[model samples]
Target: MLGKKKPLIRGESAWHKGWKDLFPESYREVSFPDKLLGDLHRADIFTSCGTTLEFQNSPICLDELRSREAFYPKLVWVLNGKKFKGFKILKHLPDVDDPRLDPYDFCLGEHLSVYRRAELHSGAARPLNFYHPELRNIPFTSYYYSFCWKQPHRVWYEATCPIIVDLGGHFLYQLKQRPQLGESYPYLHMITKKAFVSQYL
Candidate 1:
């Protein structure tokens, strides 16, 4: 339901380059070629495994992150001010969670059409999740209950944690951890998601 996009602060070219450079040997601006409800929603990078990604150079709150999970697999946000006009903007805007407001902002329907399609096409018997575990800010039981409505069977509810990397004290990168239970979203343990303290540094 959190659908208010920040004022457009970044250019298309910067966003395209940023996301494309991060994930090499992957498809660029890969999107649903076929016409959906309206103009298609394109992922910045489509991994070989069909996991989609969108890079944003903007301030994305925890609730906003959860709202976006209903669409794509992950969103790599730029923490550096030098990246995008002092802020980030994404190429494709995802749909608002509320079905009524969906004007193809997210090509997938509220019924989770994209997730179903990916599951059907791929042979991997992984969990068919609409939202990524790193983005779901809700309680454990409530989260699974919603997933049930989206994917009842044949999907494993594997969760993942994130490793936030402080990029030279200016930028940050959130690397996702392996999927498992008891490992919740990273924001829970933080006073603020922007606080970057990495042991590796």
Candidate 2:
């Protein structure tokens, strides 16, 4: 819907440019007035469905994260997971009932803590039966995958909006987490890139 091609902004990374190129110019760099702050907020991509997609390449603190969420209520984060050297995507859901997985060796809210199961069993267990008191709340039916990230930015755990990571594969993984007994259990939900793009287009 754009009449003319807009000039590229300074220091815009190729990662951002690549994703923006997939959409029409009108949807890329769409701006909205922040009446509460008397300023304008520009979104990376604003789709026909009114969902604002923010392409994040670097780490951001909790304050900025909250501010962006507040400014754009219907927001979805498309993060560049390749930049994170510590981030590792393990095989699909591990067996929580496996005795090798020591329930006592986990730290509250740490993603790496639970990934120990992946190292121990590596998706060898069957049926996905979870008997441990700490694992009771998790929804096993979801397309959840175990992951381990060394010292992942804690701010992401605070994100209230949907977040999907681009790890340079055929699919984008949605980061799903739930707080139980003051502890955090984070996992990944895989969706093909074709499916993700088709939905917005």
Measured by TM-score, the strongest candidate is 2
> Could you give candidate 1's per-residue lDDT for residues 78-183 as a string of tens digits?
3333332322211221222434222111122233222222333455424333355522332232111111113211111122223332233334534332222223
lDDT tens string, model 2, 1-201? Answer: 858855567877788788888888789889889888899989999999999999998989988999999888699999999898688876455433345544423333323334333433454422233455555554453455778888687788889999999998788999986443335567788899889988888
If scored against the real structure, what TM-score would every candidate get?
0.32, 0.73
Off by over 4 Å in 2: 1-8, 94-142
Error of 1 at 85 (Å): 15
Task: Please identify model 1 stretches exceeding 4 Å from their true place.
Answer: 1-10, 13-16, 22-26, 33-39, 61-64, 73-201
